[model samples]
Target chain A: MKLKVFLAVFACKLTIKLLRLLGRGGTAIPGKIALRICPDLLFQLAKDVKCVVVTGTNGKTTSSRIIEEIYVKAEASYFANRSGANLINGITSIFIENSTLTGKPKKENAVIECDEAASKEVCRLINPAVVLVTNVFRDQLDRYGEVSGTLENILIGIKNSPRAVVCLNSDCSLTASIAEQIPNRVIFYGVDVPIYKNPVSEVSDAPHCIKCKHEYEYSYRTFGHLGGFCCPDCGYKRPEPQVSVTDILSTELSFTKVRVQVFGEDDVITINLPGGYNIYNAVGALAVSEAVGFRRMLAKDAIASFTCGFGRMEEFDLGGHSARIILVKNPAGANQVLNYLAGLSAETVFVCCLNDNSADGKDVSWVWDANFEKLADMSELIPEIYVSGIRSGDMAVRLKYAGIDEDKLRIFDDYDELIDAMKNQSLPVIIMPTYTAMMDLRAKMSTAFGGKEFWE
Target chain B: MKLSICHLYPDVLNLYGDTGNIICLKKRLEWRGIDTEVTLLPIGANADLSRFDLFFIGGGQDFEQEVLLTDLHGGKDKEILAAVEDEKVFLCICGGYQMMGQYYLTHTGQQCDYIGALKLHTVGSDVRMIGNYMFKCAEESSGSTIVGFENHSGRTYLGEGVSPLGTVLHGFGNNGEDHTEGARFKNVFGAYCHGPMLPKNPEFADLILQTALSRRYPGTVLPPLGDGLEINAHDHMADRMEKQ
Candidate 1:
């Protein structure tokens, strides 16, 4: 019976691979079968190899890629869902890509980036050896309901899985609270990065302490409550991280650089990503790799060479100017992009695109909260800012208030107009787009410019 | 010299990036040599509200409003009531406006008692309100057309004599009625438009800070904001929202 089932699955995968080779969207075919039958095979397959899974509301995509890159540098074959397709189909698709025709995976380790709700189901199937959660924020509230609910899903996966969890000690109050739930070794990663240049603190979502019901006080905030924090009443402070990222230099004139003071030695890693959150993302990766038996030096070297893990921080030379393509799906991600753009030296133009798709909360109010004003405060350097998307008018209004000059502001709710506005513009454009917006931006880039060859 | 600003429950009622509103106000005020002290008073933050010059509240989910209502209801100091009575500047937007009124009707029809500042009532239902919005600020409202996004699941009704912040541009406008987009009692101003409110709208921040300045320094002449102020071309959005 098992032999027949294996044969059918193997044949299905073979056919899909053929279809993919022949130019089709056959990537989802493996998941189409695995999510239904032989789901048990996933856990069995992962037992022999080291599997590190990172899932949370934010920072998981970048962190997962960083971890995978570290493993890749160590010469260990790794596979991760780099496309931010963090669901059942996405996980299965990643596993299938790493698998051979005989149902055995080619890689020794898999870094699966699971979605918030889907993480539990995928972990139950994959039984990963390590899990790293970056931070939790009030993202897609219409979809995820609340921050507590998102944390509950992460806790569900962490509680059941016997694998060690590399948790972010600074993810507000709830993420650290989950440290008590999991029996596995919890490796916590955090940063002591300074927010000096940024005089005022930007307000972020999801701040109530789960225990005392009082707002958690921040000694200092890197982003959201993902820094030193403590509750006033219950004394539930942010856990003392086992692995801390200190001496973090976010004042990078180029290449979102930071020196992570890990294990009594400063491991300086210059990442091709942007924002202080990326520092946390790297800390999440460095913490996980170090916990999973990779030497500290080897892990640092891996992240050092790692440039642009997929579209997380992909730089594109469009005709003449360089465009850093970073995905801004939610407020935290969007705010980080603003932070990066604020520190950038290039003659900058911000092409902020908004979409009401499932990834970008149908609630565009999240934008009103992002620190566009801070981006606006640094406006002397900024010549023009392009606000484009289905919600271009919204972004245009946002930049306008950011004290961005109307002439400097152009609203292109239409992609064609956005690309037309972007094509060979004199200033170095920072293509800060949401999820599917990137697809549209990439497609336009492919046709207008050369192709996805910029990624090469 | 310490001017206390009430960043009221920023972590909780902060639906939009209202924290940016406070950040913009603080930085701008500080730029003008005001010794600005921002006290983030969460749901149960330890701080004296009586010393507060500016009281600020952002938007949030209906559940968050419900959760915070009891705490906010209890913590309503006489100083806050006096501030409202005196028409001192308190910046409230969207859900904050809804919750600051007499009552907020939840989706289940339960009446949640508001702080009774605005003469209005907001009722929530199943259908959520989320989209980019614009508003034509009143003539006295010396600022650009208020442009931002409104994401809420509530409908607010302004009673007689109440004026909205401006005519709604896009988004759901103002709840179900053609009511005022925001509420004002002297220095206290409320609106639904948020793009983290102030970051994108320095003019509005200046207006709020001017209210603070008038209250604090009396007849002190304030210099106008320096150069780099640009006229944002979002009139198209206002035009589009008006047609809708």
Candidate 2:
């Protein structure tokens, strides 16, 4: 190794140790320092390690965790960035921390969740063995500019990794279109059957055909713009998936049982995560595992027992009241959370924390697109609605306009007061926070309740 | 009194929660005991534009805008221009705002013809002007400060015949260099604000509603509903932007 590489590794390792000692779990700064020392350190370290990269607007962290679970189940030596640090810097930090002093990777395998915008640079450096795109949706419009712009970024990322086998969500019209352009070997995975009996009309991100301007016709819609989409004019239809969820047996608040078919065989798997979106995640995870040559049974076992990382339906005990935190960043993801909320049988205190922080998409207008109007139907189950975060006033206005009773809308800008307000509640509390709000609120919740720090 | 709302190109140009503006208008009208009917007029949908009192057109991606341009050329542009001439209440935002202009010049210098309903034209820029912004409405528009989040690469310029909808108080509006935020010709309103530009700004929503209502029922005055929550939301955003 060069002197610069050795120095970069040493400096990065020291920073990680110091951060841990100081009880500050920051992944970006350490890697940033190391990169400044040795610009090619990540490429040098990641060259030998087999990596599976997950990138998309949503389900990236969950899909990464599910792949991590497969690695754990198979007893494969691997390291993953599990603390919601998916950027190039944060991912570089993970690689540096997992490497030996001489800059050799400690593990032969790795799972990385990459941000949509940062995926191109990260993929170019890592040159992953398997690249899984969960799905694309209109996310953080101010940051991405447009959903098509986001898709272009991911496409560029895929183009950079020619050797990597691309695993895609065929149900997503935007995601599936990548197969038409890229030269990489592709494996498609999606839900074959409709996830909902009565699907609500959603404002689709890709209503017009990706290839042609004609509107798409769906045989069945799973959620949002995902489904058996076919452009009548262009003949651009959903490609047949090699790995698919044949049926959704049952769905509950905590878990969902699905009959998934992989490699011409069907297995009734219990996805520890709930919602129709998780089913897609499970299938995408399976596709990645299969592409990476993991045994089907081991991947199935991992799927059945997989637990989500922080803030992706992360549950906690708030002084005896059950509190579940669902991180929502975009309309499609938020709609799924709202769908989950509408399905709850018992009365609950619904909390929506919105922030205009950069990571949370400074434009909070997406709250309106999330179909919060669905809460009107669940007024009986959702008795109290708590709106908190920097943009709590905006969220409160959105909820009120969504037909939520003004009497139930409560604004709590302070997280401590918000948590205190929910402490005595006997009803289950569902907290839907945007990305930045989730990080801050999760820290506060963990500090009060005493849970594992995110880094650990 | 009942009013008909024509939501133009909902499937194509419905980005950044622009649908919220329609929802706000519908609910606000219902709250005041006014019956309202909203009709979605997507591309290829042949509907008589004369029947609708108010029309809404939202922003879309560049690709969608190209597709919309092709579809609009098939008589919809003429219908929209005629509607604007008749002083129909039209609310166009971002991409929709650009489409109401004489033409849109892309960053690459590709000019696309629009409806020519307003004496304005948009020029695409490499840098997207994005952030929370506050603008003071023109004197004719109640002069209230309207707060919204704008995300657009198009720099729109008002021509001699057109008047500005508002003056920029904070952040970039229309073009980054100009103080003008939007274009207004008769009852047609076009702006870059798409915090959907309605739910938080009750006055603007009411302005559109009142414009549509008065056109149908001559000399009718709209009764004021409770606007405390709406005003608070609007003020909170305006204050936040001002501080920034």
Computed on C-alphas against the true complex, the DockQ of each candidate is 0.25, 0.79
> Chain B of candidate 2 versus the native chain B: what TM-score?
0.98
> Model 1 TM-score?
0.75
Give the candidate number with the greatest lDDT.
Answer: 2
Q: Which regions in candidate 1 have their CA more than 4 angstroms from the true location?
A: A1-30, A33-49, A100-102, A249-251, A256-261, A264-274, A413-417, A420-423, A447-456, B1-11, B18-57, B61-71, B75-244
* Best-matching candidate per DockQ: 2
The fnat of each candidate, in order, is: 0.42, 0.75
Query: How far out, in Å, is residue B191 in model 1?
Result: 9.6
Model 2 Cα lDDT, one tens digit per residue, B1-244: 8999999999888889999999999889888889999999888888999999999999888777767777899999999989999999999998898889999888998988888888899898888898899899998876778999998888999998898999999989989897999988999988899887998888888888998999999998889988777888888887777788
Clashing pairs in 2: none
Q: Candidate 2: which stretches are off by over 4 Å?
A: none
The C-alpha lDDT values of all candidates are: 0.69, 0.90
- Lowest-sum lDDT 10-residue window in model 1 chain A: A447-456
